[model samples]
Target: MEFDYVIVGGGSAGCVMAARLAENPRLKICLVEAGGSGRQLAIRMPLGVAGTVPAFPFFRFANWAYETEPQAGLNGRRGYQPRGRCLGGSSAINAMLYTRGHPSDYDGWAARGCTGWGWEDVLPWFRFSERNERGTDAYHGFSGVLQVGDQKQPRSMSKAFIAAAREAGYPLNDDFNGRVQEGVGLYQVTQFFDGKKRGERCSVAAAYLHPRLDWPNLHVITHAHATRILFENSRATGLEFRRNGTNRIVKARAEVILCAGVFGSPQLLKLSGIGPADELSRHGIPVLSNVPQVGENLQDHVDFVMNFRTSSTESVGYGFRGGWRLATEAVKWWRTGEGLCATPAAEAGGFLKSHPELDVPDLQLHFTVGIVDDHSRKFHPGYGYSAHVCVLRPHSRGSVMLGSADAADAPRIDPRFLSDERDALTLIRGAEILQTIMRASTMAPYDKGEIHGQDRMRGAELMDAIRSRADTIYHPVGTCRMGSDAVSVVDPMLRLRGAENVRIVDASVMPSLIGGNTNAPTVMIAEKIAGEMKYNL
Candidate 1:
């Protein structure tokens, strides 16, 4: 098959590119996805998101489930990093919070030489691609396929969390995507009207791909895993892909956009002989572009949880009763689109500075009404309130490298988390801040007692407990960063440093992880990239 554009990985960015590029009507585009179509009920229900991981058949099958190399700093524990394998990619499996991050985030991106990616330059596109339920404004749009809306139902505990934050001296923000992000509030979500019902979280697949299924000029091939890019004289022309034991080649006449995300994009590049020459030679892959920085500079947020038992019998608890509560919540959502089911597990959160001298917020807090024994769903059955304090702008760095030349092989990912003493110190400080907030007057009314066994511990013991329980908040980026420097993988326009007619349009290109959730920013990157591609074409 041949097309004007061959977009690999029909994910968040690829979906946007397909929808936006196909607007011309004359262009023939092919979007190949390694996963099947996203049609699971769990993906559509806000609360049902928890089931997404267990329902693996409905997800993208091509996901290279990579584990981080054992980290000496993390007690030799290997982290499980899950990237999406389906049409919408991680956007389909993620908590649907829509946040554009702080303005300084983009300013930093621009300052790093990502020319057109500054906040002011990218805000318009963020607005252009969104149809915010809050209505139109200088920062939001009213007419776009992607739906951004206030949560359909606010959890009862949300108010308490907000009050506690305010009582702790942080301001209450109505909109984090607005002028400032340093406040506690209910977050907006990526949702749309699904059959007259509002607050129906919309995935990239539904918003950008499914709506265009009837376009004759566009071909969407699912279950097709792109193995390697076919390049000649530094120009990408086609790719080799496999489906059901059969290998096939598809040609791209114009360009190839790799939206395979942070891990897959770099792995594909290395498979196509575009990474570190030394590594490629060892793997016996011919070097097409010896870009040593293809998979370096990885960063992510790490979180520590502090749980408190609430005296209110109405508190959502764990076990069989919790199941019943969740069932009732689901019924409420089905009938009224309002209830606990409509709320993300984490109800309210805030961004704060670890130190007063810092110019921007460095610590983040996510307040959850229900207790999480383990991040995994299997162990998440307790009834309590919890706060997750995360260190934003971590100084730690990691890398991604090839395990072998074969596309089927998983890449080695090492997030060297907390390697920097500063990162560990920041997290420890964040835990102390959370502890102070829990003891505040505003939160006293809701506090029944401490839940964690080490609740009575203070000072050194508390810090040690925090360190033992800290886990990832699931935000990872910068493995294939974009910049003007030689060490960078992609350039300011998202093009690979030494590759032509190919671009990476996903979280992998993020030069730095933003202060909050990455879903909204990933979508914004796609929106901005589409405009740039359109304008240049």
Candidate 2:
């Protein structure tokens, strides 16, 4: 079969691409996804992050439960990498925080040879795609595809965390996505709210694709695994995929846009012979282009989660009382879309600098209303709260390589977290700040004791404790970075070097890691690319 455009991986970017391009009515677009339809109850409910994010075997229907190679820095433990496998991708499974990172983040991309990616140039696309519930402003849009709003019934513990941070001297910020991205405050979430109560998750599929599913020019195919790109010499002509154990080809009459995310995108590239020469040769595949940086320069935020037992029932936990509370909350949400079920447990967080003298915030913090041990894989008995401190830009870098020639096998991922001394030092300082906030006067009424403390330790012991606990916050980026340099994987227009009719529009194309959540930026990239495509057409 053939279409004007064959977009692979119906994640965040793919949803935006299909929706925008299909608006032309004359242009035919086919979106191929390896997962199921994204119309499940868990995907729409905001609190379903608990089941989808940690991704236990039984509940991982919408999650690609990929694990990393054992890290030498984290006491030789393999880390979990739970990517969203359905249409909306990780946005459906992630904490619903709507952040654009720092404006400097996009400027840094332009400075790195990506011409039109600077903050001033790309902000319009961000504005064009956002439909914030807080009303239109210079920074936020009102009538756009994606919806951003405030939480309906955030737990009291979340406010206490902010109050404690303010009491410890950090200024309170009203909007993290406003003029400045530095300070402590509650985060605005990506939810579809109505008049009064909170709302459901506004995933990319829900915001962009679901609304336009019946559009004549758009076609969505699920359970279709892309095995390789159909290439005629240097041009990406179509895609070879598998469905029900049968191979099929979907020809791209216009172009093949890839939105398979950081790991999936690079893995497909390597599998289709568009990666490092040595890597392709080792995997028994002939190299089509010698792009050595296809899977290089991998970066992620390594977060150290600090847990504390709390006496207050406001914070989340797993017990008889907590279970009963959830039962009532479910009813409340169904009736009015208000209660704990409406909350994305990671309800509050902020951007802050490690040193007072630093220019931009080098650290990001997430305050969870529940104990988040081992990405919530390890469950505790009683109620507690968690504070996560992550290095915004890590000095450590790693690579994604072919584990086998087959596309079915997962790629070998290694982020080499905390390999640099600077990251560990920053986390140690950030941890101290988190501890101070939890122990402050505002939290005294609820604070019981520390579940995992670094209070008594200093220096080496503290370093060891950090090494033992540090893991990725699931913000891996930069594997297929876009730039104008020779070593870069894609060019300024997100086109692959030495290749024709192919482009990337996802976190894989980020030249540098941004300072906050990546979902918003990924959606913006798709908006920018879709605009370019329409303009040129």
Candidate 3:
């Protein structure tokens, strides 16, 4: 098969690229996804979203399922890393919090030599792709396919959490995606109001793929796992992929874009013989390029939850445990998308600095209506209000290396979390802040006692408690960092530093993870890359 573009991984970025490139109608584009189409109701219904996790139809089967090596800094714990496998990638399974990150985040990218990616240049794409339900403005757009809107009705717990943050001296931000990202408030979600469904349901697949599937120039192939990139004279030419027990070679006359996300993209690059020379040679794979920084600079945010029992059972946390109340709520969601089903797992969040001297927010707080013990609902069942504190600007760095020459083998991932002393200190400070917020006037009305058992401890004891409970919030980036430096994997234009006819358009290209959720920013990156590709083409 041959086409104008052979885009690998029909994730967030690939979808945008394929959809945008095919707009000319004369160009042929092949979009390959290892997973199947995200057409399940669970993926469409806002409340049914949680049920899609265990459903092997996508997550378990098509996902690469990469886990980090036990980090010495994290008490020798290996973190569970889940990347999306379907048409929309992580955007398909992520909590639909739409955040563009702090303006400084993008400015820093430009300062680091990623030209045309500064806030000024990138903001246009952000507005271009977004069709805000609130309507268009200088910072927002209403004509795009991607839908952005606030929750239909803010959960009671979310309201209380915001009030508590305000009482604790934090500002009440009506819009986190607005002029600033600091403060506590209800998050804007990537959803559309569905009258028949009683709630909002939308995703990148719905925004970018579903609307354009009928386009004759666009060819979407699901269950097609790209095995290797076929190169000629150090330039990407085409690729070999496998689907349903058959091997096929496809050519990209223009470019072969890799949007397989942070984990999958880098893994595919190394498998295609484009990575560190030593690592590739050890696996007996002849190196196509000697790029030592192909998979360095891995970073992520780690969150620790502080749970509290509430005396006011009227709070939203009461419906968490399974029973008649939970069943009733589920039925309500089934009938009308206006109950617990419409609520995101982490509803309310705040951004703050761990220290007074910091210019930007280093800590993020996610308020939940239910108690989570190990990220599994089956493990813990109870009525509890919890706050998850995550260190935003972690100083830790890790890498991705080839496990072997085989494309089937997963890459060796090592996200050296807490490797820096500053990260540990930030978490300790964030935990203290969460404790303080709970004591504020807003939470006084609902105060019961320490539910996660941190109230009983103080000083060193609290620090220990935080260390024991801290886990990743699942935001990983910078593995294939973009910069002009020789050590950088890709340039400001997302082209590999030493390669031609290739580019990486995913979270892995982020020089650093943003302050809050990364889903929105990942999509923003795709939109930005699409514009750049169009202009260059």
On TM-score, the leading prediction is 2
C-alpha TM-score for every candidate: 0.94, 0.98, 0.93
User: How much lDDT does each candidate structure score?
Assistant: 0.79, 0.88, 0.78
- TM accuracy, model 1: 0.94
For candidate 3, the lDDT comes to 0.78
Q: Write the per-residue lDDT of candidate 2 for residues 42-72, one digit (tens) a residue.
A: 8777888888899867668899989999999
Give the alpha carbon lDDT tens digit for every residue of 1-537 in model 3: 899889998888888888888887778999999888876656665644454443344336434556778877767777667676788877777667787778888898888888877888878888889888888887888888788877876667668888988888889887887877789988888876644533555678778987899899999999888899889988899989988889999998888899987788888998888888888888888888888888888888988877766654433443444456657776777777767667666678878888778888888888866665544333344466778889988898888877777777777888887788888888888888888887777776666776667855677887677666677777888878899888899888788766788988888999987777887777778887777677767
Error of 3 at 363 (Å): 1.3
Task: Please count the clashing residue pairs in each candidate, in the order shown.
Answer: 4, 0, 1
- Model 2 bad stretches (over 4 Å): 195-198
Model 3: CA > 4 A from native: 52-64, 194-200, 309-331, 444-451
- Which 10-residue window in model 3 sums to the lowest lDDT? 53-62
lDDT of 3 at 170: 87
Q: Tens-digit lDDT track for model 1 on 1-537?
A: 899999999888889988888877778999989987865556666665554543344433423345779876667777667666777887777667787778898999999888888889988988888888888998899888888877755666667778877888878888888877777788777866445545455888888888898899889999988899998899999888999999999999998999888888999999998988999999999998888888888888888887777755345566777778778877877787777766666667888888889888898888776665445343434567778889888899998888888888788988888889899889888887787777788778778776676545677777667656666777888878999887788888888788899989989899999988887788889888888788888
State in Å the error of residue 272, model 2.
Answer: 0.5
